[model samples]
Target chain A: MKLSKSEVEHVAKLARLELSAEEADRLTTHLNGIMAHFEKLQQLDTEGVAPTSHVIPMQNVFREDVTGPCLTAEEALANAPESSDGYFVVPQIVEV
Target chain B: MTEYEPVIGIEVHAELLTNSKMFCSCPVEFGGEPNTRTCPVCLGLPGSLPVPNRRAIEFVIRASLALNCEVKEYSDFYRKNYFYPDLPKNYQISQYDNPIGRNGWIDITVDGTVKRIGIRRVHIEEDAGKLIHASVGNESLVDYNRGGLALMEIVTEADIRSAEEAREYLVNLRAILTYIGVTNGKMEEGTLRCEPNISVRPKGTEKFGTKTELKNLNSFRAVYRGVEYEVKRQVEALQSGGRIIQETRRWDDDRGITIAMRTKEMEQEYRYFPDPDLVPMNFSAGLIEEQRSLLPELPQARKERFMKEFDLSAADAEMLTSTRAMADYYEEAVGAYPDYKGISNWIMGDFTRMLNSAGIEIDASKVKPVDLAGLLKMIADNVISGKMAKTVFEEMFNTGASPKEIVKSRGMVQVSSETELYPIIDQVISENPRIVQDFLGGKEKSFGFLVGQIMKYTQGRGNPQAVNQLLRKRLSETKG
Candidate 1:
């Protein structure tokens, strides 16, 4: 369960984070230490135990199908970094 | 040449027909002003929590039951982490380990043989926003109106062996979904979409070759063509002693070729974990029973029933049951007039043509179900000739007028009575003496010519059967 430096770099690239060489090495060690601590719990015999997804026992928390109020165009675009003509603008996505 | 077989599996995404978004109260609509449907929960703002839509879950359960899938008593939603501009949250809330439904099967008829395509799983997820790229400038815009919408992903096993089978499978699946009122299944509007993963393997080999994922197939025809191109490309590469590479491909529809987008090595690892904000779904036996009762007669079942109940041919039944609205229209018309074949002929023939040319659905057409039945009754009662009925139908379709009104106003009544047609027949006989001589001289084709003349004289309103009988009696009388 040890994390490799390359694995950490790959994860950082996927997250769109520009990590330096020093940060990558340090993060790898930190992640490995966390994984090693988690590995200690694997020694316990926990067969037939269901994996819990949520801490709360609540299920089927939902709202009705009816629509309520929505944000106006100006309000929605207020926090956007860049906008034009009632839309969020971003860099061009190269077609594949 | 070496023998190769193509293996294909299709994954389809259909937007659920709900009033609101999947986790937010923004209206789930198709087209609107950009950013008008945004909300904090959908925009993934800090401190905003997601609450699932009840009707969307019910829809998924109903769809699962329709597809003969096993509904799990407990299913949890996971956050599939990814980075995309259209994804506001940078992670899509989807089901991974425990999907809502699994192990279902759909039957598709390929070349007259019913082949059951295995359904791997059906899960619910939130849709990303739309990205619109400008042509003149190097800029892209995002419309969050479609963000956080409920979408159901239906994945099928690699059971399809040909492009035709894939096409049929999609067609049948769309029909079933539309029949259950879960999704509109409109592929043109991007509400419904399909992506096929295709690979080639040696004939009689159990192992599958490297498969490519195809995207941007907008229609069923595109699906068929894309799979065909991919299968051919793979087979050619194998024949040339080249190894197939797993990649994502885009269908170049205009060129009819699949272009590689990215290889599998570039595939992102979607770290999926349960969403902490939303709770898992739990269904009781009573709830499952209630959802099952909500299932309407699906397309396949209704198609079979149509064949048995209406005594329709397989092709006719398939055409009539193509869409739920069309099927309902057919049934209502049949109720008004029990002549099953007669109603089938009109709907499958004239009504369908009108609908196609006018670019409208049967329910949206001016001619209602009762109107079609009434027009068919006129043909049955000899009030109008079949040829004349076509004209009347055109008029009725354009004006939304009833059949009786159109017939009376246009003076298109059939001249079926003996007394009314006798004089006209006599005039035609005298004027076309050569045709009469030919008829008496045993030129049997002249009889048809004479009938055509009478119909022409009566402005295409002559009862053809009555005209045929009267012409024969007069010809015999002249001989005697």
Candidate 2:
């Protein structure tokens, strides 16, 4: 069930992770351990048992069509790490 | 062509409409400042334990019952461990082994037929924050505004046959969620999301094939296109003797393609385990029944009623009942008129056109149900001709003015009295003797020209029905 170092590296690349060698090795073991748990699912007596997807016995939940409060410009910009006036400020990408 | 079959399943994540966050009292409004709505519970601060939102639980249960799902009286929460900046808690608190509902079926309309989509489970969970990828020096920013939002994951069995069917099922599910008032079902706002499981097998094959989970399809069109792209891609791969790999695909709405995002992970990917902080849920039988009774008339029943009572065609019924507000408006208009065909024409023709133009929904219209009723009544009682009603309708929509008041103020009322209409009719016959010759020469459409002339003389206020009667009677004797 263990993923090779190359496979671990490949997965990290796909996920766009900047993993160190140690982290890569650690994730290899973690991914393999996770795959092993799924392997146990193969042994369940699921031959005729249907796979369960939802747990609630309810349906047709709806709301009245109405508009609620929208965010104010001040409230919308409150949490930005950087902001100016009433908008979220980010580093400029285009050169003048 | 080797017989190929399509296996389809739907996963719907519905945001529970609550006044506050799932585990905190912070306002659960969308698009607030990144951290303005956050509290210790939603921010995942140390020593903050989440108390379940009772209303959220009830809403989920109500939704479950509406879908004919069996409610689990006792359920527990689990921790899905993952590492994402948007997820304040590295591990999300979700239901694993004991979800609140399971084994349900939802019927959706497809091509004038009802197709039942089996639901697998509906479980309560918390939503993560938003990650905005900025075009910066290679880093993305995380906004915690959406953290700790209540969400229910509705899983459906692979009972769908086509991408169109899958889209219909998703739309029906959204409609149900909105109708129950559980979620707003605003895909653009990310209140409701649909992830499709698609696979293709040899035709008539009983065994299932490898399925890929496609995500990021935020719109109905995207859901259909994503499933179609994946199905064709898988079928082509299998036909070429290439193995189908299980993976997670991201749907590109612009490109209209499904791109492989990452390899599909098994259950251990998140390292799920029961959370030690939260208590297990225990509900009484009465609570479940109460929640079930809270459900309103669902779309299927409403559609059937529209066909039976309103005598609407299948297509018109489908269009009208797609949303609750539209359907409600249609009924209110009908209640005012009691003339099914006339009301349908007004709603489907002018009402829809105005709504589309103003970018407003029926519920949000300034003109209320009584306003629509007033306009239709003016036409029904012949206080105003059908042609004059159009002008009054524009005034009603523009100023929220009642049809009666507008007609009285602008002197737009039709000449319904025979005494009032006969003078206009006599003036028209004497002015246009040649046009009457066309009517006598078997030119039936030319009668409309005479009506137009009569209407012009009355400044478009002539009672059309009276004018028609008078024109036919006087012209019958002048047939030289």
Candidate 3:
């Protein structure tokens, strides 16, 4: 149930978050506290309880395969931080 | 060097042939102006929710049923979090714990042995956008038009042991998917993509070695070559006392090698959780039955039926039933003319050659079933010789003209009557007295030369059978 500093750093890296040493150490303690609380909760006898992914009981919520309106290229790229030739520009990606 | 056994399994991702995107109403098309097919939901704009496409789900079910997968009654979508430029949402909605179908199997014939490869699971997911990198610099462009498109991932058990088996597995899988009308199954267009995880082990070892994944394999040939290269690389590494590392490798098709992309530690841990926006799917018995009924006869079954009913060889049956449209064309032509082998020959020979050369489907061609049947009937009734039929077919293919019309207009009718060919035969004999003397002097080739001359004199419209008979009679009468 203990959350280590390296685990926090790894998680941050996966989320594309750049965390300093101080922040990583602080988050480790904070996350460990949260994990301890969850561990305490896990100790209760709830073996028969059904696992629920969502609180809502909705099932088979689907839309028909009919196309509606779509955004123009200008509108789609309007909010992009950087765009060129109707495309969102990013730094060169070395790996896929 | 010790012999090693390689274990290979493939993961195929196919885009569903739906009218709209997976979670939005944007049209799901292959190519257009970049970013034009985007909507708020697909672009991952703030506060937008995703709604599943019904047809896409049905397509997954149909594919699962066709592959002999047990369709699950309950399935839910999960969000797999990752960071990539193509994934605008920073996550992909996919199935994790409960996929739509599981425990399926597909049978592929490798080296004349039927091997049943187990299907682990078939899940539905959304495709990310495409990234186009600039040729010379560290700059890339993203197009979200393909974002949020419906994709079905089919995972197979590690049953394949060779590159040829992997290729056969993909071929059969593509045929089945195309037959069910779920996906177009065009690998070249990037609709169907395959990745194989391969590992090598000592010949008698029961445990698997560290496996490396081959990615971005676009064609069956690429899959075959990629697996072959990876297996050999792994085997060589083991032989040199080098440890194998689990990693992701890209198939350098031009260079024909598997280049290391990233190590296992650098791989994303796709922290998956249930997406709160979309609800779970619960299939009713009626619904599953309806979807099952919608499944047409798949490729394997149709091939067997063709062999049984038409009395075709395995190769002929397989070639004729390669595609659904081709199979239907064959059936329709056979219905019109009851000569199974003749129809099979024409379809498998000239028909397929023309299709491959023109890069078109059978339905897209000008040659209709009736036209083909007419051509075959002409050949059967001796109205035109087989050699002449080839020319007539080309004319019909180019002009869309009927076989009868082409024959009549081009004066391609065979001269079969004895009364008509007798004088021509007599003239040929008199004109080619030297050849006649050569024939009388027991030169066997002179007969063929005279027949050629007679055919040339008749403008290639002579009935070869009658010409052969009459020429023999005339030569013998002169000899007597």
Candidate 4:
């Protein structure tokens, strides 16, 4: 399926991405090409094949609830642009 | 105005008391120095993978079984995508479809009628960081210590009809969760959080009005008041020919009203999908039965057992079984002493008052069950009068001392012997000649006055029964 300009913009917005008009157009063509490849594969689907997220049969991977180690506050915030009072400071949020 | 009914469904997010974080080994704790518990995995640094916590999953399973839910055989984890600074990762690891537990119910008695509120699902997820806004700044502070803590979200169906019912349902739900050793279920400390979505429908109408979700319900009273205020606000809006908008509302505790939040509900969309980093958990029959067997007798069953075993009334059994520690305390104390009803009276009356005033629970109490039974034994053994035990108990509560020690240190033993009490009784008889004369003249109430004087003279340590019999003998001899 071909994605319209608005659909491309909506996807970018959901991803919090800012795309210029030229960038949107170029991505749209690339996305359509990827969709065409999927369409060709869609025609070759076997009826009895099961859908899967992983190739191998793997489940129930777990870790014991024992605590090990944690980074100091300074080390944790080492890469952040700003921090104060042992906290990561950000602009006042507008969240629901 | 047309009559309307308010519909409410509550959602609870309780932090699991795991020793470590959900996907990492960082310690999970509350109220530590900011950012002290962060790691590469929880802080969302690149190239770090998450392994699920076995104990955390078992905690959720325990709670689900206690709530009478059907534990699913297959469960998958998903990432709920959103934009929030508190979330180090933009998407929170959650369970979107095929939650671990579903279709459960808990019974709450509101207005003397038992009703089963439906539990839609109980899913596990990670908690976001805490945000504290500076009073005068344009920035907010975030503490990641609470981040990545395992949280279990229990969503209830729209079965509540009033604010009171909503409060009762939460009370009953918290009891069950805390009883099964899953979470602390502390709302004030923010370990347990409740959000109620409310809507109002006009009488005889088949459609529901637009609903609003409420936030900042930190206590049961707040839940009651917040829901009550929202119901009234919606009913008033409909009565004024104004339509309610579907949005999130903040409960303004100071102003005591629900104000619409600035964020538009339409803008908040969580596109959920299965997280590729984590694998799905397929429960075996043995595994599910293991969790189910770990489940203890829940609050309801224990309450019934208490009534039959302890021979307690409905209210007494309910109060005793309010918390697991409390019920255990009662049973242990009764085991020490066979006076069941007498122990119940002390726990429900003076013990609870002392605990409430001290702002502690039975588990944190300084007075142990054996200590209380010891205090009662002092009275039964005639070492101290019932009246003298009150003073001894106050000292015991403050110092956690033994009843014998308190009585000894305070010099408050009961004077039961004739040799010890005869002098004080004689002194009272002579000092109150008017009362003695009144008794001789057939004023029967005058004898009670004489007994009071002797008790007052003895500093309330007089054995009341012994003092009564001796004073009667002395007064009759005076008449002869």
Candidate 5:
């Protein structure tokens, strides 16, 4: 299944990525090339093959709900592009 | 013109009461310096892998079982990809195709009729960071303190027919969650949230009209109002040949209207895919059974048992069992004193009043259940009159002192003995000669006046029963 140019554009829009026309065309071609390889695999189908989302053959990997140490606010905000009053500041997203 | 019925379903997102974040070990609590509760995994730092929280999953199972949902044997976690400032990860770990629980049902009562709401799914997800819009600048502050906390979303089928029914469902859902100790269920604290998506259909039509989801319904009253107003708006739109657009609307509480949220918000498309870092949850029958075993007596069962065991009215039993702590308090007090009616009366009356006026919950009150029962015992033992118990109760509530101490310190023992009350009754009879003559002259209400005088002279410490009897005898002797 080849991805159309518009589909790539839609994906880029949803991901908040600005793609120029050249970048969009390149993505569409690269995405279809990637999909063409998957198309080759669709030719061979084992009817009884079970669907699996995990390849590790594992389940129920969990951690006990015991609290450990947390990062200090200064350390947590050190990597932010902009910080103010111990908060990560972003452009206003909410209209109201 | 045909009548249309409003079709509504509610979604409740409750933060699980846990000690740590969903995927990390940061403490899960409210009101901390912003971002102090962050860890690499919760903040979605590169190279940090996510692990499931065992207790959080168990909490969801307990709540699902309480709602009568079937626990699935296996469920997978998905990454819901979206670009929002509040979500540091840009993709929230949630459940999509398979959730922890499914097909549960809960019963809510409205207009004296019990209605069952279908539980569509109960899935565990991580909470997003809180966004505080700045008042002075065109910027918003992000607090990751609430980020990655374990949250469960309980979605219901479109079974609610009216606003009142929707309100009842929310009330019942909150009670169940709080009773099971899964969540604090405080809407004002933002630990619990309710959203209802509403639509209307023609009376005989099988198809549903378009729906608009409502947000910012912070309280039960707001839920009711938002649903009521949305239903009206949809009906008006249909009547005027206007089509309802499927969008998300924000409830403007001050203006009491549901305004469509910005169109950008309407572009929310969560591309869901199973997350590779976390493994799928596989619940053994043994685990499910164990969770079911740990399910405490829910509100409905406790309410019924309270009515039967304590011989309380249904209303009183329901009130007592409204919250687990309050019900437990009542049971503990009853255990100490065993006067069911007396304890019930005090808790429902003055005790509840004190708790409300003090702006605290029953568990936070200074008055212990045993102490309250002790006060009731004092009234029963004739150590104090019912009138005097009020003053003693206030002291007990304020100081956390025993009833005996408060009564003794105040020297407010009841004058129950006839010998002690007789002199006071005689003094009242002689001092109130006009009331006596008024009584003898067939003005029987004047007897109540004489009794009031005696009670006043005793400083309201007169045992009502003994005072009534002794005063009657004293008036009979005076007539002779």
Candidate 6:
């Protein structure tokens, strides 16, 4: 499927990124190449054939029901851009 | 409008119970400080190389065999390129071309009917860091404490017909996973997650309609309700001649609605390619059989055994075997005392009721298996009447004392000897002359009152069965 220039811009906007014109152009060519590869898969007959999504066959993957450790307040906030008493601080969220 | 058929698929992410991260020796513990559990390997730092955890791969084989999936002799992991703060490497090391398992089915019971849901594949992958939205002005902060944990993505074919079937599928899947000791299957902590790709068509058409994926459903109830709401939303859109857009939606559990998050990204957009950093993997037959041997008796088999060996009803067996802990408790109790029916009654009746009321688990209770068995044995031996047995059991739960000790300390033994109760009975007969006359005058019910009086005089320790028989015999002899 060929994506118009406008569609590429729309998708970038929805993803919350400010892409420059040159970046959008580069992404368009790269995405187009990727979509071209999928065109090969579409050519294969799949009338009743199931779509191959995963390679390994597994069922009932489970874990034991037990609780372990959690991160401490200091460690959780260590990488915060900003912080306050035992919490990650950020810019004020609201205005009256 | 043309008729359409709904097609559904499920993608489940289950966290494996490995002691360490997939590629690093860092401990795989939940709820750690940001970046504390991280090392050079997990952070995708320069000079880091990935090493496979043999235990994790073995567990994958065990799970694959349980699901009846075929294991590829040669398989490998690939890089799924993406950019997000949660994903520090901007790409996830996932299985792209070949996964660990493929083509399996799980049997689930939906509304008293058994249905098989096809599993597409189960592949190994790394988990992303949790993003905590601090709701700061115009932006949300992110936390990387949980980044790079090991997880398996189990995707299912679009074969589910209803939300009820989806719930059953999850339950059965969780049970099997728990039985195999792979993932903890804990939804509260995000150990097991279900993302359902749901679409609705007219009741009988063959073509699938456009579907939306619902995410962030943490519980089974949320999944069912979310799917139901999505179905209704799609159905109404089709009826109104509006197109159903392909998108990803967030499940609002508080409001019970599936809100669209963003437009669904097509597979082509991710630009998936084989990871060049890792080599293709292979497994021998010996590896697969090794995992198979470690398997324990699963819930279905245990349920059948409960019915045949313990004579438990289907409902009782299902309740007892709900978890490994509860099943083990029941087995231990039965092992101590071979009275299967007696243990079942105590477990299903008072023990379960007490556990529920006290808001504690069976394993956490002060009562032990041997103590309960001993209590039941006392009742079975007629040393304590059933009524007195209940009292002793409660005291046993509170004090952790043996039932024999309680009975001995409280003088609760039933007075079964006739000589032991003869004096009390004679006094009751002489004092209650009017009642005795009424019994002889064809008022046979008065004999019951006489027996009660005798029991009261003996402080309820009189043998109830013997007292009834002696009272009836004495009253009949005086009738002449």
Badly placed stretches (over 4 Å) of model 5 are B252-256
Residue A89, model 2: Cα distance from true site in angstroms: 12
Q: What are the TM values for chain B, all candidates?
A: 0.96, 0.90, 0.96, 0.95, 0.94, 0.82
Any idea what lDDT model 1 has? 0.91
Expressed as tens digits, the lDDT of each residue in B1-480 for candidate 6 is 655455679999988898877766677777645556666566676677866666777778788878878887767778886666666677888887789999998876666677778988988888887655554454434555556667888888899988888877787777778878898887767999999999987777777888888898898898888888888788878888898988889889999887776442333356677665566666878777887788788777887899998998888887787666678888999899988888888988988898879867687888888889998888778787777888998998788899999999998898878788877888899999999999888887898899889889877777788889887777777775
Model 1 CA lDDT for position B320: 89
Report lDDT (Cα) of residue B325, candidate 2: 83
User: What tens digits encode model 4's per-residue C-alpha lDDT throughout A4-32?
Assistant: 88888888888889999999999999898
Ten contiguous residues minimizing lDDT sum, candidate 5 chain B: B260-269
> Could you give me the TM-score of model 5 versus the true structure?
0.95
Residues B57-124 of candidate 2: C-alpha lDDT, one tens digit per residue: 88889988888899977787888877666776778999988888999999877877878899999999
Best by DockQ: 5
lDDT by residue for model 3 (B1-480), tens: 788999998899999999999999999886679999999999999999999999999999888898899997889999999878999999999999999999999998877889999999999999999999888777899999999999999999999999999999999999899988999898989899999999999999899999998997888899999999999999999999998888899999999999998553457689999999888899987888899999888899999999999999988888788789999999999899888999899988887898889988888889988889989998889898888999999988888899999999988999989888988998889998898999999999999999999898888888888889888988899999
In candidate 6, stretches whose alpha carbon ends up further than 4 angstroms from where it belongs are A1-96, B1-7, B31-35, B135-141, B220-243, B249-268, B353-366, B394-401, B409-480
Candidate 4 local lDDT, B1-480, one digit each (tens): 699999889999999989999999999876778999999999988999999999999888888888889998889899999878899888999998888889999999887789999999999999999988777678888888988999999999998999999999998899999988889998888899999999999877878778999999988999999999999999998999998898889988888998888874248678898899999898888987898898778888898999999899988898898889999999999999978898999999998999989989888988889989988988888889888988888888888898988888889889988998999989998898988999999999998999899899889899989999999999999889
Q: Which regions of candidate 2 fall more than 4 Å away from where they truly are? A: A1-96, B240-243, B262-268, B310-319, B330-333, B417-434
What are the DockQ scores of the candidates, in order? 0.80, 0.07, 0.79, 0.70, 0.83, 0.10
Candidate 1, DockQ score (0 to 1): 0.80
Candidate 1 lDDT for residue B466:
94
Kindly report which residue pairs in candidate 1 clash with one another.
none
Q: Which residue pairs clash within candidate 3?
A: none
Better of 1 and 4 by lDDT: 1
Flag the better candidate by TM-score, 1 or 4: 1
